[model samples]
Each structure stands twice: as C-alpha cells, then as structure tokens.
Target: MMDYKEQREWLQEYLPQYMTEHLKDKNYSHFWPVLNAEWFKWLCFLTFPLILFQQRKILQWTKLKSSAKCPKKESTVFNDMLQPKRRAKSKAEIYSDIYYNKRIKPLVKAEEEVGNLLEDEDEDVKAQVHKMYEQQWRTHENAAKTNVLDDDEGDCMLDAEAITQGIDDLSIICQ
Candidate 1:
C-alpha cells in the first residue's frame, strides 16, 4: 500500500490527465483553477450515463439483427430521485408550508385587505421563514443535547427534517 502523501500526489497528477484525455481537449490548462481533483472524480463518476447511451445504440443495432432486447431501467441518480417514488414529505417541509400559510399569508392578506402601502411584504415573509427555520434548527440542537443518550425517542430525528428543509430551500433558491 502507498503512503497517504504518495497516494495524494498520484491522484493529483493522474486525475487531471485522465480528465483531459476523456474530455479530448489539450487546451484545458486554463481550466485548472476551476477544475480540481474532486471535480475530476465527479466527472469520472458521471461517465456511466454516456457509456450506457453508447451501449443502447449498439443494442439497438443487435436488436434489429437477433430480435433481442435490453430491459430499460432508470440509470442515473438524478433520474431516480426525480422519478417520484411517492415517499412522504418530512415535517420541516410540511411545517414550512404550514407556517408560511399560517403566519405570512395572513400578514400579506391583512396588508392586502387594508392597502398596498407596504411594498416590503415579500421581504417580511422571507424574514419570517428564515427566523422560523433558524428557531427550528435551534430546537433540534437543544433536544439533541438534552437527550444525548436516549437513542429510542427524541434523539436527533428533528435535525434530519431541518436539513431536508434546508436542502429543499436551497434547491428552490438555486433554480
């Protein structure tokens, strides 16, 4: 087995070279600052879809000749996640929608019922959601601390909900 330093150096040298070849471009030297070993590893991982596509083309040709077929299945992680396996939504997501409807919607409706003077209601709603999310996370953290050894109930399951909500919010914001 190689030592840690040697293994790291080997990876640092090999990954970029491998990416450059797979990408079929020699003028990628300028891409070095943005592309790192981790990015190269991700690229390597994502090549499975390309391979599957190529295989599908070849299989189509053979299917025409021998009447054989390749069974189609979801291949990529993104495709699988987007396929909607009908899992239940977490409490944070449900609660975020509920709290927004309960708290923020009324404030906006009340503003609407009165007049359109407050132009910052959108900002107010965003602030309320942020504050509520922070409070939820704090509550999870406190509960986790208090029940450090209670692995049966009220352990740290709430943290997962908060994290799922954070991820959902991030995906929305990114889009």
Candidate 2:
C-alpha cells in the first residue's frame, strides 16, 4: 500500500514523462487537436443530455418488460435499478433556462417573450443597484459613529520637542 506522499512523488516523477511519450506518438496527433476545438467543447456539453435521454428510454423499456413478464410480482433488472434517478429542476436550473433564452433570442419588437426577458434583466439590475446603495449607506453610517480622534486625545499625543525630551529623560532615568 503506497502512502500518499510516496504515491504523489512517484506520480510527479512518472506522469510528465508518460504524457510526453504519449503526445509524441502518431495516434495522439489526430486526437489532441480535438481538445482545442469548439466542437469538442459542444460535444462534451451534449454528452449529459445524451446520457439522460438514453437512461430515460431504458427506464421506459424496463417498465414495459417488467409489466409484461409478471402481472402480480414486481420484477426489475439490476442494471435498470442502478440507473441514476433524474432530479427535478432546481431554482438555479429554472433561472439558467430564462438566462439562456434571453441571450439566444433576437431583440425584435413583435416578439413579446423577448420584451419580457429584457424587463427581467433590467429589474434584476435595478434591484442589485438598490441593494448596493443600501449596503454603502449602512457602511457610511457605521463609520460616522466610530471616533476617529481617539489617539490625539490620549498621552500618546506628542510634538517633536516632547518626543525628544521624553527620549532624553528615558536615557537619564536608565543611567
């Protein structure tokens, strides 16, 4: 069993050399360029939806097969049971849809949905500005309440002559 420090050291020494050798191979030249392209990023983005759609189809087929096999007892495939359950869309997800459509849609007068979308963004901006203003006002009010002249009122206050005299008195006292 390799400890974490030893494993890390081994990987640090070996991984770069492995990567360099792999990159030098003829097969990697064809594959490496895909990593830098926009299509590959889009393909990566689409993978989740493709996987979800496949899962949904499998779930439906499993239900149909199970119902046909035995009417009384419930029978389910282990593979189908192991499939990840799709979660309900959260507030963030709902917001993302609105945001995506707002950005993607054309700005045309006839399209009411586009007009409504713009209003949502404008309202959000206005609310954010109002919140920022309130926060600034609160900070300013708190700063005003704090005394800024405390050091000047105390014995710590001293002119250049006073400081020099105090240093001379300190030397005389020490002697």
Weakest 10 consecutive residues, lDDT, candidate 2? 26-35
Clash pairs detected, candidate 2: none
**Candidate 1 lDDT over residue span 120-155, tens digit each:** 478887688779999999999999788755566555
List where candidate 2 sits over 4 angstroms from the true fold: 1-121, 151-175
Task: Name the candidate that leads on lDDT.
Answer: 1
Residue-by-residue lDDT tens digits, candidate 2, 16-112: 4434554344233443353325324433435354656643553354346433432442335985679776788999778778875675354443476
Instruction: Quote the RMSD, in angstroms, for model 2.
Output: 27.3
| Candidate 1 colliding pairs | none
Locate the minimum summed-lDDT window of 10 residues in model 1. 65-74
| TM values, all candidates | 0.18, 0.19
TM-score of 1: 0.18
Best by TM-score: 2
TM-score result, candidate 2: 0.19
Backbone clashes in each candidate structure, one number apiece?
A: 0, 0
